[model samples]
Target: MTRSRKTTQPLVKICGLNTLTVVDAAVDAGADMIGFMFYARSRRAVTPDLAQALGEEVTGVTRVAIVVDATDAEIDAITATGVIDMIQVHGKEDPARVAELKARTGLPVMKALRVATKEDIREAEAFFGAADHLLFDAKAPKDMKGALPGGNGLTFDWTLLDGLKIDMPWMLSGGLTADNVAEAIRLTGAPGVDTSSGVEDKPGVKSPERIRAFLAAVKQTHLETAT
Candidate 1:
């Protein structure tokens, strides 16, 4: 089975953004999407008001609100801000929940599936019709301390996706950085890629230089792939 791509070039989403500076940097650097963490436990989390303020002036880049098993009120508050273009459910939300969120928020949903093995990938099929897009991320070890759902910066085996078939749009994520993203795309033939902790200086701090370097690397990869 062959995987499908949404565009000729791999789409880039820089997640876990909290400041306007990084937001501006991502947009200026030609990012396809920018994410705001709405989960309180995440070090990179931001309030709906803060996300709104940071995303208000942004254009051309899709703004995504990332949540982890959010309640109805929590989702309502985030969507009420009117700053998000997409909703990324990063927890244990099943296909039913994914569809419900789309109906409730009137926004496209991107369901994040944590992959530690082939079985996890197979389970993602449940969301095929429910979600608009799917994100494959590394599942942290159960014993790992201080691990968040999606931004733990751990990478999975890209080969796990080899020959796997899917009909909907999906993204490759987890520990992707300037150093390895090109190779990741080469291996998985992923149409889109997302990075959070990979571009950070520390747990929650994003470095402008690293962000620029990462984007430049992806751009170069796209250029090479085109030729």
Candidate 2:
């Protein structure tokens, strides 16, 4: 639903914000989007009221909700608060579920596709027209114990997506930080980027300084990559 892929500004989204300081840093640092974790299973989860409070601090950054395998009631309850601008489904929600949620909320939906191999990208085809955006994250290992779905800070082979193309717009995430986001962006040609643990000092704790550093890295990345 956004502009065509031919334009590239490299939008950056800073996720897992649970504090005002980090929120301010992201905004001041020029992040295009800011995400709040609402999944109870995630260590970075925040309450609806708290999300509203945090959202108030961001005057311009797009507010986002990162949700997991939640029910309609849960999603609606959060949407009712009227603070979230986008809903990021980081679970096993299929294309039909994506359509249902979009119809009910009248809000844009971002479908997350966890990638570990070439075939994984095809899994996202179903969501092309169904979702407003796509987020590519590293797939969690099936046998690895204690994997808590998305936001595990897993990193896949970035090279796997080199020169890749897709119908729907997408963002790249997973183990991305200020240190390597530029190289990752160059390799994958991802038009947008999302960061979680990469900007946090600890699980559920975001650092303002880290946020600034991260934004600076992306600005530099954009310059270096541009001819």
- The candidate that achieves the highest lDDT relative to the unseen native structure: 1
* Reference-based lDDT, each prediction: 0.90, 0.85
Count of clashes, each model? 0, 0
Query: What lDDT does model 2 reach?
Result: 0.85
**TM-score of every prediction relative to native:** 0.95, 0.93
Give the winner by TM-score.
Answer: 1
Candidate 2 residues lying further than 4 Å off, grouped into runs, are 1-8
Q: What's the true lDDT of residue 70 in model 1?
A: 96
For candidate 1, the TM-score is 0.95
**Considering only N, C-alpha and C atoms within 3 Å, which residue pairs clash in candidate 2?**
none
- Taking the tens digit of each residue's C-alpha lDDT, what string does model 2 give over 14-100? 999887777778888888888989888788899999998888665556789989878989898888777899999999999999999
- Number of clashing pairs, model 2? 0
Q: List model 1 lDDT by residue over 110-175, tens digit each.
A: 999999999999988899889999999999999999888989999999999999799988999999
